[model samples]
Target: MARNQLLNITIWTALLAPVVYIGVMIVRIQNGEWDLLGPEPGRAVTQFLGTWALNSLLLTLTLSPLKRSPLSINLISYRRRMGLFAFTYMLLHLLAYMTMMLGWQWQDLNDEVVKRPYMVVGVFALLLTIPLAITSTRNWQRRLGRRWKKLHYSVYLVAALSMVHILLQVRSSWTEFVVYSSVLSLLLIERLLNRQKTA
Candidate 1:
């Protein structure tokens, strides 16, 4: 198979998996199964989205390191697409929190963003994603040249902020945060090692 075709399949699969999961959750809610797994619908939905956001972010960060493995070179071509999908999930996460939890109330939105540190961090992460997602396009990559990479480096900041966001929200659940932190650490270490080798 062509590299692009494989990349397309990977991208679609990654993107669709989350959509399917969310659809199933919605169906369960409609069927009155949501309460069976949680104390409240709002909490369950928020938890799902928050977990998905962090997972997608970790997946994006893993792509580069995984590409270094001989068996995983196919992932390199799809890294940009995967990163964009991560941003998409982050956006959905934000939308879910706003629509489900805050109910689109302007005052609630203002108070949450101003009073909640985690919410602020989440918003910052989302904003950081914009440049990376926008530059993922081939045309933008060509137009930006060397600047393209410098701009996309924002992903690291996005990842860090995302970690902070999740950690603050979970407060007690260190398991997910630990897993993501370990992955980020390994990816960063691999990047540094590669830089040293090239230098």
Candidate 2:
């Protein structure tokens, strides 16, 4: 197969794998095969989606630095798609939390947010991701011109807020915190070094 075809296949597979896994998990849960989801299926699904969203966001951040490496494989072209997938995962995470944890009680948002300040940070990160995802198109790039770059820079903030959100979670382990923080720090440092070299 051609290299581009291979890349497309790889990208689609990576993107769809989570969706398929979660779909199957949901089916299993519906079928009373609770072992897959364990006890408290809602929390399990919410955490699963949240973790993938964070992973996807981190992957999106890695694209620029990867493109600078010898093993890039032209992956930069798919950064926008990766970012959109990150947002999709985040949306699902929020929906899962709302439906499973809160029982879809919209009015409970205030209490939940107050009870868990991390929810505020997570929701804010999601809000920031919305504009970036919406304006990710080539047409939007052309229309926004220089402003587009500035707007998309908010992704760094989103990434930081996401880390903070995770750190604030009482159930988040130190190991998880260290791993994510290390990855984000390394990615940010790579971008800074690259900027200095270009300057």
Q: For this target, which candidate reaches the highest TM-score against the unseen true structure?
A: 2
For model 1 the local lDDT of residue 107 reads 74
Model 2 TM-score on a 0 to 1 scale: 0.95
CA lDDT, every prediction? 0.79, 0.91
Q: Relative to the unseen true structure, what is the C-alpha lDDT of residue 114 in candidate 1, on a scale of 0 to 100?
A: 71
Error of 1 at 172 (Å): 2.4
Residue pairs whose backbone atoms clash in candidate 2? none
Which lDDT value does model 2 have at 117?
98
lDDT of 2 by residue, 36-122 (tens): 877788899999899999999999999888888888745788999999999999999999999889998889888888889999999
TM-scores of all predicted structures: 0.88, 0.95
Candidate 1 lDDT: 0.79
Tens digits of per-residue lDDT for model 1 on 14-103?
667876877687788889786754777766676676677777777777777777777665466667767776787778888877877888
